[model samples]
Target: MPVVGIIAEYNPLHNGHAHHLEHVRKLAADEGIVCVLSSNFVQRGEPALLSKWARTEMALAAGADLVLELPSAFACSSAEYFASGAVSILNSLGIIDCLSFGSEEGDIDVLKTAADILAFEDDDFREILKSELDKGLSFAVSRQNALKTVLTGKSGQNIEKAAEAIDQPNNILGIEYIKAIKRFNSNIEPVTIMRKGQGYKSLDRTSPFSSATAIRHHIRELPDLRAISNDPFLKSNMPEACLNILIKETESGRHPIFPEYYSDIILHSFRNMPAENIASLPYMEEGLENRLKRAAIESVSVDEMVSKVVTSRYPASRIKRIMFSMLTGMTAEFLDELKSNGYAQYIRVLGFNDTGRSLLSQMRKKASLPIIVKPAGYKKLDTLAKKLFEHEIRSTDAYVLGYRSPGQRIGGQEYTSSPIISVR
Candidate 1:
């Protein structure tokens, strides 16, 4: 089967996601659609509103043939590494024909041009980037300025437009996807689907294709989903099937998990974690861990904790990743070793349909990494792979602790859970 891979958070499946999937299906045609979705946490450095399993069901219902988990190491990380991890998994499968993503610009040529410049960062580019950083600009701003400076120096190119492209969220992610494809030297073609409706941070629900932020805000405004059936506006933002699944999950007290729900765990973990240990976390740098440690003792809430540590150079998202890494016991030493290895050791399947099964059958023959369709499958992995996967399992256990229903807070969901097999 010809398979197309998508890297997404799918925090909750909304109309924009459905629209993207429809375009992906059109691009794949008779091919299967495979997705590498964030598990428990998202790239935005927050817990997913819905569980991975529910999101998998939503993807399956929305025409995705297969769903795979992007481990927490990648799921809650910055865009570059997140794309790297997801693309690596797709490439390892060896069956994906293309990598599809939604982008505001929707132009592959422009994204590739920028990605090529970044992937091949020369001495001049590095110097420019260093100069920008020396000016005390944030990494994002520095990188954009450096890229724009470099692009403008090039002859006969639309430097102005190319420079502005990286400032947008989707375009930046698209560039990372392209860079990852190049890094792996994979054969998967890159495709960008034009994004619809309000911008990424917009909270407007008037549009049919509202942002995930908007959808979450809309859901949070209500006391309960008891009136969901009558809310035409809410239903219009998402697919009916996905909306139903969300309602059911919420009713069971499993939907809409916010970061604040797990603030106590994070706060306590931070307070107890020795100052020496904080330096060992991936991305913890320049005595920022000490700042975080101090904030942990001083702050009363997750928002305040992050706010206290956030600086121009270190954004809230970056702070969240560091905090989450600490919560999940992700160490700088371990992540550095993992980066040296430079490949996903295992593929953890989240869900599949008949077409996906066929794709999996083909994957078994072509894949370079171990394909795990169940939690018990972790036992068959090697020592290093097992250690890496244990982090994922621990993250799931942490995720369940935030569920609204105490009765549903059972752990070992990763160990006992089987992949969601969609009959569709």
Candidate 2:
């Protein structure tokens, strides 16, 4: 069967995600759908609304055949590393024929052109990007300006259209995915599904196709899990299967996790670390560590601390990632080591259906990397792989600290849990 790979967080799979999966099914003729899902920590540098297993259950229930866990390190990093890590894993699978993602700009050619420019930056582009960066602009803005300038001068392309295409969050991620495909020289073809619904960050809840951000916001505002599960807004917005799984998880006190849950621990972590140690964390630069340290000392919550330290050059997303990195003990040295030794070390199965089981059997023989169905399999990995697995274990332990139930907060779930098996 031809396999289509999707990279996503699926924090709480809603109607929009179901629509994407439906299109992928049609595009692939209902062949195997493989999702490289984010771990407990998502790309936004916050704990996922539901556990990875619960989210995997939702995916399998919705339509996915197989779900693999994107290692926490890459799952919580910036778009570039996140896309690179996920794409590398899909390529390693040795079965994927296409990579499907949602984006505002549905034109694959437009996205590909932008991706090519980014993947193979010319001297002029680099110089322009550096000049923009030096002016204290955010990396996203700097790249947009550079891309617009290059596109205008080089190809006489519609500069405004190009800028608009890359401005949307999903479009930006789509470009990164294509860029990673080019970087790896992978055989997987890229496909984009134009996003339908409110904008990525919109909080509107009137439509059935609501943004995940809106769904999460709705869940957070509710008084308790019972109230959330009973909310008619959610019932209208989420697919039935996904909504059921979400309710089940929330009833168990695992859904609706927010960054504020980790405020105390994050502050504790930062308070104990000196400025030098903070400087060692990944994405640290320009003495930002000193400012972060002062923010931690002065602020009472994660939001306050982020507000204190965040500037135009350093967005809140980056600050949250840095703080989570500190909490999870991800360092510059560790990330460098990971990059040197293939971005993703192993394919860790989070959940699978009957179709997925067949795919796994084939993957055992064809995959470039080991397929880890059980946590004990980590014992057989090489040095770098083992280290990466251990880091994920620690990261999961840190993530669970945000759980509402004390029993769920226990460490070592990474080792104790097995992949979720769903029979459809």
What Cα-based lDDT does every candidate model obtain? 0.86, 0.89
Q: What is the Å distance of residue 389 in model 2 from its true position?
A: 0.5
- Per-residue CA lDDT of candidate 1, range 1-424, in tens? 3578998887788888898899888877767999998988888888889999999989999999989999888888888888888998999998999988889888888899899989879999999999998887778789999999988856544455678799999999999999989988999999887898789989987788889998888777877667766677778998999998888898888767888988898999889888888888877777877899899999988999999988888888889988887777778887777667774779999999998999999999999999998788889999878887999988888889989989999988888888899995
- True-structure lDDT of candidate 2: 0.89
Best by TM-score: 2
Give the number of the best model, judged by lDDT: 2
Please provide TM-scores, in order, for all candidate models, with all chains considered together.
0.97, 0.98
Model 2 lDDT per residue over 185-283, tens place: 999999988898889889998999989999999888887668766789999999988888887887786656889999999998888798899999988
TM-score for candidate 1, please give it. 0.97
In model 1, the runs with Cα more than 4 Å from the true position are 155-158
Return the clash pairs for model 1, or none. none
